[model samples]
Target chain A: MRSWWRVLGVVLGVSVLFVGAWAEKLVVIGPWSGAEADPFVAVLDAFKAKTGIDYEYRTMRAEDLSKVLPAQFGAGMAPGDVIFMWGWWIAKFADHMADLSDVIADVPFAYVSPLVVDGRTVGVPYVVFVKPGFWYRKSFFAEHGLKPPTSWPDFISLLKRIKAIPGIEDAAASGDGVGWPLSDTTEHFILAYGGVNTFLGLIDGTIKWESPEVRAVFENYLIPYLDYASEPIEWTSALDLWWEGKYGIYFMGNWITGMVDDPSDLGVFALPGAKAVTGGPDIFFVPKYSKNLEAAKKLAAFLMSKEGQELRAAGGGKLVVRADVSPTAYPPAERALMKALEGFTLVSDMDDTIGGEWQAAFWDQLKLLWVKPGALDDVLRVLDEKFPKG
Target chain B: MRSSPRAEPRGKGEGKSRRGLPLLFWRSSRRREEWVAALGFLAIGLVLIGFFVIWPSIRTLWFSLFDAEGFAGVRNFARLFGDREIVDLVRFLRREPPWGALLHNLVWIVIHLPFTVGLGLILAVVFSKIRSWWVGIARGAIYLGIVTPLIVGGVIIRFLFDKHAGMAPQILGALGAPVPWSAGWTAYPETALLALVIGSIWLWTGFSMVLHSAGLSTIDRELYEAAQIDGASELAQFRYITLPLLRPVTLVVAAMTFLWELKIFDIVYVATMGGPGGASNVLALEMYFSAFRELDPYRASAIATLITLFSLPVGYWFARRRLRR
Candidate 1:
């Protein structure tokens, strides 16, 4: 009996020690995985090593994030200490967001815009996404003696040339299924055809939907471009096709860098005729309702830190938020991406400009336009009546 | 062995005295005991219904008359179909899935009803006749769909229906009646709705089959035998005996199917989200979109109310028939 008690005591002591070494988890939720989330893993691992604090990062779909966060906020349930969010969601959940001005004061002004709601800085910025880069297989372009175009007419000619290749299905097509990728790209059409002021005019009501400029956007830019694109499907699957050399080109975001199977073989060019490349960061914020507010703040602060941002940009193929952190500091992949972004004017995406309420209706209309090309007049008429500007 | 007149009076006197001595308001002790037991059984269920169903439905009804701002009357309902064009009305009337939420739901009803219940009834008939070691295995195979969750089934369907890699287009192409599904059916407007319908039928035909197989068990076998002995053909026997006998079961299936269609969410949600452009958009998806995306609970509530109103007539008929039978 004495011997058995001694063995049991030894086992219990080891168990207690093991349990004592583990910290309580600080849960963070976001829409990222694979290459995207891998960077955060490295950053978080460093945080854990430094502070002896642990975290579980959960990935969710953007659509579900929109639904889940609001419901969680409404129910007074803090699902996590930190959340990754899109621009429009910041508008919807601004009240529940903890102001991150103290943390993000030194971040670049461009990255700061999405997080500011009603003059309150509600989020810390990370993972800058640019929406105008068109990617193609370098070998495919080289074999065909093709070159990237400098203008819109040249771009169309290039698409036609790519199409003339024996079995090419599309020169470019959006991963057009649910909402985000297509909606992100649609604003580019407005920029490409009507110019930046014309695009902004529609938002402010100076330009009517019935105006010739908006009509030209539908007839000239959106429809003509979609002719070379594939039918609507999930964006991820579409990205897979781009990787497989099925589609010769895909005009989407820089996040595609994180998704590429091989970095060296990829060729990217800025979208032609757009006034600027329009997109911004996937902002990370600690919510006011967070159960682990201090830990969340620590995580956000670490993400913005030079060492943390470097690991994130290198591992995640992301752009840095800090102005001082140059592309040269990043790994070759992101460094190349930053080099590609030079000389292009940068503007905010429609997600930022259009705001939240009208965003859905607008995106859905774009989808409708892609399918029912004949429904353009009717759709615009409805959009005008529904969202009339003076 | 007739009882004497005094014997009768004694029995009558005991009964009369028992009835006359109702101290605790129990005229009949056995019936009162039965009533108490029945009430006890219903108490939990009633409380659940009151808490879960009744309260939510009442709130939905109240919310329907309002808009995002406040109680703006039936303006939300007007806006629900407010954007519809005359051509759209014609398109919806023609039973197409592209035009309107209400019309798409109607198409879902038309497609889902016959495909689910009819296929189920046919499968049930085929299943009922078999008696072998393979019986359980075959039945299990048929019920495999019902066993799989809707989300899983939807994902599988999406893969099988992929434009480049899916089996659907390949099979359809082989049939020589090729659909323009080179991009997959769900990638296009008209066909996205059809894809969802096909996927739905795949998921729920088994559900209908299970209900029908259970219904098939209670049917009297002798009726078929009697008709057969009288020189009736198998087809004639089914018509006279099985079809007429299965009316009640059919009503139950129809009512359940209609209700399910009225509130159907997962298939469309997981499969297409009423896209490639809101082409396959149904009332349930619209309600959810209106609530979350538009943040207009009034419009969402109105759509919910519309679904309920649409279901009431069929539900009422089912209840009435069930009570009568």
Candidate 2:
């Protein structure tokens, strides 16, 4: 009886040791809610099937992710082995992320080139969208004798011509009364003329805000639009303006193409400027305290897989990250975006929702300044103070 | 056995022998128990106070003193003071057209408070007069609004008020009125306020009504009968007796509503994000932008501290009054 008891105890101990040693669960954090969950869920399933490692997924808003991550890293709770984030957020969370330089050798050229943070690869690109392109009603544009303008001066001339039309209102300039489209258009124009590097330099105070080039872009491009937008913009009433064929031009993202899903009323075209190409990159990162690094790497690899790249195209978007995928992975609008990408500089947009020093200084303060009329000099001074010389 | 006569002397002798020590220990033990009870209560209270009130207050106070980097000192507060909008808001008062969103908050409170309280009171009165089953159903229906998540409510409200194809414009358009009710700031502030108020009232009126209904149940029906017999009209009876009787409840509800209105955020964020050029930016939203959204935690804390300071005195005074009564 004593020998039997000893054997039982030994067996129990061995089982316990085995269980403790081989406990594997991957913790993943990403924006995978509702419709966004499909691609991630499929990829996670594929990973599980391949590696036999189960994952715990936590979906959070991109904004909340930024706020929570700092504390999560600070408190050693960042159990995120893999993370899906917006393009601009990667820069803010660069310190806490692991180097992906080895991993990037396998990614596409487009993703590889732009997301190089401080000579270290911080994140990998997965999904890409551009916000400042001109999306116009094709039927209306055709009727009103409008074509996609390929230069800053031509774009203004087109706008002037459209505004001169007897009863047409300029595409919904409400922006919650901030009247923001003017600046967004102006920034793109500046980028087209001077390139992305020059534009970023201006924002960071390396290039002077008072320079003639910057002044010319604003005075020539932005002021005219603002003058046109002097009338009260009724956003709620302007909903059908795009669909009703009442408005000829709308400055927005290609994602607005979904609005034309009714088939008969859909038309989208790229904005043309001196720098005829414009778009922003999407970046994904791995959080510092991820419990399952290998599983995360596998998932990241899968996201950049051929099948995953096809999902991006299926969602009516672009996938420039996977080396296996062709440029044909982009839809019509995205194809134009791809074509335009060669000439115009890629805007180094940051997700302001991510908490950063640059966020408080440039994004939020600029938003407030854009809304209310305040001292431009003071605003510039504050921006310079925040981003001074380095 | 000489027991009866000598027993008294024996008892007396024992009492005399044990007098000082027994009395001293008995009194001391009771005192010690009382002290323990007092200390135990104090410890529990202290823990509650520390967790809920003291710690957050200290953290906020500490945060306000520093800049966004949260070093040690009054730089953030100094910067807030130095901000042009804040300066102009204080110096020029109403002379300034836009008052750094401070005026917007005041306007929100002024516009929404009366409507919320009045509607709540009416709902309470109606609910009280109804049968219990009807009251339950009505209560449930009202609570549905409250139970709906703020984001859901905000989203629905946004859609309901969408400009061209939204329910309002569609209804109006169907009625052959070409008016644009949900368009720009010039036309939409009133509509926006209405939407916000409608949502807030839907979620919160039930709470106030329930409080009022509870208050109503405690009222003496005999007093109402006497008033009615005395030829007092319903309005007069309500004004004179019910209003005075319900004042305590009114005070509680008003303060609660005020605080809730002061901290109004999620609905606005979900709806318009205080857009159309700061049309709906209440102080709470402004503070949030200052802190988390903008990463200006210092200014955010300062604004929160000011709100806390403003609320504390009133809260304490009311609490003390209620306790005394």
Candidate 3:
């Protein structure tokens, strides 16, 4: 009777130990929500099936992350073991993220360099998207005898011709308001016309925002159709306008192709300029306070692997950043984005380079400048107030 | 038994007879129990108020004095007023982003607040005379807009006035107005806040009506009857008796409505996003943007503190009136 009681105790303790070891969780957070989050969730599901690691993904938009992450971090709550974030958010969260250079050593320098802060790679690039991608209806371009423009002047001429096309009410479509839609267009234009140094200089404080070159880019490339273009609506509705065949060309990210009704009917290109392409990659990193750092690192390493990249592409129709990984498995639009990323001086989007408070100001103040063009100096002055000149 | 009787210092009759002073501050058995009972009743409520309200307000005020880097000073507040864009607003220059946004919020208060209260009062007055279940149903129907999520409602409003695919332009065309409905009211800065105001009115008038309904229930019917018997007109009865009696409720509701207007965030956020170039921004939404999007907690806290200070007078007035009651 005494030996039987001892055996029962041993069994109970073993079972508890097994459960404790296997049931530990790894949490992940990202900025994709609603339908955009659906495919990514599936990819995580695939990851769990392949490896016995258990992780939960929480969806947060950019604005929500700005508030929630700080609050969570301050309270010593681990918001995520692994955080899926846009590359631009690296600066804002660098202090809280784990240095991942050695973890992602197999990833190429080009993909890893953009996310470096204070000489440390803070995140691993997992996905990529090209910006200022000019999307037009394939048949619409054919019907109007318009070929993709290779020069800035040609692009403007094409826009004018599109306006002249009878029954085509909107010659070009740009989403309304003070955010990525407008700012991206301005950023790429500055990159394309003003060159890469002029673009980078905006972030480094060497280039004046009110310079003649910057003014010329807006005056020649943007302001001509400012009043003529559609009123500022959100991207979804603007994409809807393109889908309905009302707009000739849409200046947006390649992701717009995913939102369209017929992906096959669209053609895309980086806006014609001085050979500088504005784009960035989506990345993930382990936060400093993660309880399961080992598991998080394991998941990130797998994510940067070729098979994992393929699984993600299959899952989210995402553009992969790894040059080692082929784009053949991705959707035609994503494949096109991959092809476009080659042989170009890749510059991060306008919002990414000058992140934090200035980005918000740029977004809000751009609209004011849009309505009152004479207030450009005032807008510049407002930005200077936040980021003073050395 | 003899020893116990000798040990008794005061007789029961003596204890009850006369107190040298009021026992309020004295730690007598009965007074101590009363104190405990009062504290016991207040314990949970006090804790919740302290944790959720008073504590956060104090923390936010403290946060206002420092920048993101832990630089302790009033520079955030100074920079706030000194901000080129905000200074533009202070001067009412109207040519820039912050200027127009701040002015638009003022316009919202001028237009949305009065109309919401007026429409609510009108609905209450008209419905107050009815003697049917349908009146309650009607009030609920008007309030349906309020219950609809702001994001969903904003989307619907955007579609409603859409210049191209929306019905507004078609209806206008039918009326021979020939207006540009395809571009949407949200498309233009001049019309964006106006569109938001109309949406706010639709959303909030029912809230006012309900508040007015509650006030109407408290007014004595006999006062109105006496006024009518004294040859008062319907308008005269409302003006002299009903209006005077409903003043307390009116003050509370109007103050609340004003607060709502000042802090207008979701509707504009989901609808206009403070655009056609920052034309629809208000103090509250700007505060949120400053805190989260800007990551400048000092400025955000400053804005928050300012908003809280503005709410204090109205809050105090309401509290005083309720206490008087």
lDDT of 3 by residue, A1-390 (tens): 999999999999999997777446777788676666666777777778888888777876665566677777777665778786656665667888788777778775344354778878787777776674677888888877899888866777888888888777667777753466778777877787788888888878787777787777767766765644654556777777767777788878766655666677878776675587677777777887887777888888877777777776764345666676665778776666667667777677767666776777677666555555666676666666655335
Q: What ranking emerges by TM-score with the best candidate at the front?
A: 1, 3, 2
Off by over 4 Å in 1: A1-23, A106-111, A355-357, A382-390, B1-15, B18-24, B28-44, B73-75, B78-88, B93-97, B130-138, B174-182, B317-325
lDDT of candidate 3 over B183-258, digit per residue (tens): 4676555566777888888888888888898899988899988887899999988888878888877777799998
**lDDT (C-alpha, whole model) for all candidates:** 0.75, 0.61, 0.72
- For model 2, residues B1-325, the per-residue Cα lDDT tens digits are 3343335366445444335776577678989999999988799889999999999899999888877455847666566556543333653353322344555555556766777677777787777667776778888887677678888877766666665436765676677764334242222433555566566777777777778878888899999899999999988888987788988888888888878776778887777566433445556766866655555667889888767766786689778988999
Better of 1 and 3 by lDDT: 1
What DockQ results do all the predictions give, each relative to the true complex?
0.43, 0.15, 0.46
Best by DockQ, which number? Answer: 3
- How would you order the candidates by DockQ, starting with the best? 3, 1, 2
Model 2 chain B lDDT-worst window of ten = B181-190
lDDT of 3 at B216: 96
RMSD of candidates 1 onward, in order: 4.6, 6.8, 5.3
Give one digit per residue, the lDDT tens place, for model 1 in A1-390: 999999999999998886655336788788777766777788889988988888888998667777777778888776788887766667668899888777766656445453688888887668677875678888889989999999878988998998888777677866764666777767777776778888777778678888988898878877887788776567888888777767788877877777777777877886576557777777777789886777778888788877777677667466777776766667676677777777777777765555444665566666666666777886687667656233
Regions more than 4 Å wrong, model 3: A1-25, A33-39, A109-121, A150-153, A176-178, A314-317, A337-343, A369-390, B1-19, B22-29, B66-79, B84-97, B100-105, B131-134, B149-182
Worst 10 residues of 1 chain A by lDDT: A105-114
lDDT of 3 at A200: 83
